[model samples]
Target: MMNRRKFLQGAGALGGLMIVKPSVAFSYAANSTVQYALLGCGKRGTSVATSFAKNTQARIVALGDIFPDQLAKGKQHFDEINASLGFPAIDDKMTFHGWEAY
Candidate 1:
């Protein structure tokens, strides 16, 4: 029963609402905790994870890698960085290896 003009107007209003700044509704507090997971433990993955660990307010909670050695290496890398920041060490239980890790 709706005409094209009304439908277009409603859609435009909805689009405007969606585009509104998110900061108007929410603010990130300093102590807020953000947890992240890295799926690949390769060179690129480890590099990116290291960057996040060193620069952000985020914590690497879970790590997944197809190779055990790579997983262990990645975990150690993040563990050392997080330790320096006084963050709790990543728990071994959160690490996953092998194909099923994905």
Candidate 2:
């Protein structure tokens, strides 16, 4: 069976990608464990980070900010999102926060 990556690569090579619009075609794959981070995790960071966390193809794995509170908030928001999407909370999947763990 043709995996998703292979299908997309094939489509791109054939110039079929443009015909379908890559973003539209790949939207469903947007949140598939693609690890992202919140550099700020303030209002703007929360928005962008949450958007990706809610995706079916992405996961927010780590967060970094001068303020520790921002990191905690980001992780909390992502946890709620993941649970609402029927997936286990982030705490169940992996460790979050702190540069030492990275």
Q: Of the candidates shown, which would achieve the greatest lDDT relative to the real structure?
A: 1
User: Local error of candidate 1 at 37, Å?
Assistant: 0.9
C-alpha RMSD values across all candidates: 5.7, 9.8
Residue 61, candidate 2: C-alpha displacement in angstroms: 1.7
Q: Each candidate's TM vs. the true structure?
A: 0.68, 0.51
Q: How does candidate 1 fare on TM-score?
A: 0.68
Q: Write the per-residue lDDT of candidate 2 for residues 76-97, one digit (tens) a residue.
A: 7877787777666655335444
**Alpha-carbon shift of residue 100 in model 1 (angstroms):** 1.3
Model 2 residue 8 CA deviation (Å) reads: 23
Model 1, span 1-102: residue lDDT tens: 999999999999989867676554355454477899999989998888888878888888889999999989988888888889988878999999988997
What is candidate 2's local distance difference test score?
Answer: 0.66
lDDT of each: 0.86, 0.66
lDDT minimum window of 10 residues, candidate 1: 22-31
- Report the error of model 2 at residue 7, Å: 23
Highest TM-score among the candidates is held by which one?
A: 1
Pairs that clash in candidate 2: 31-56, 31-57, 31-58, 32-57, 32-58
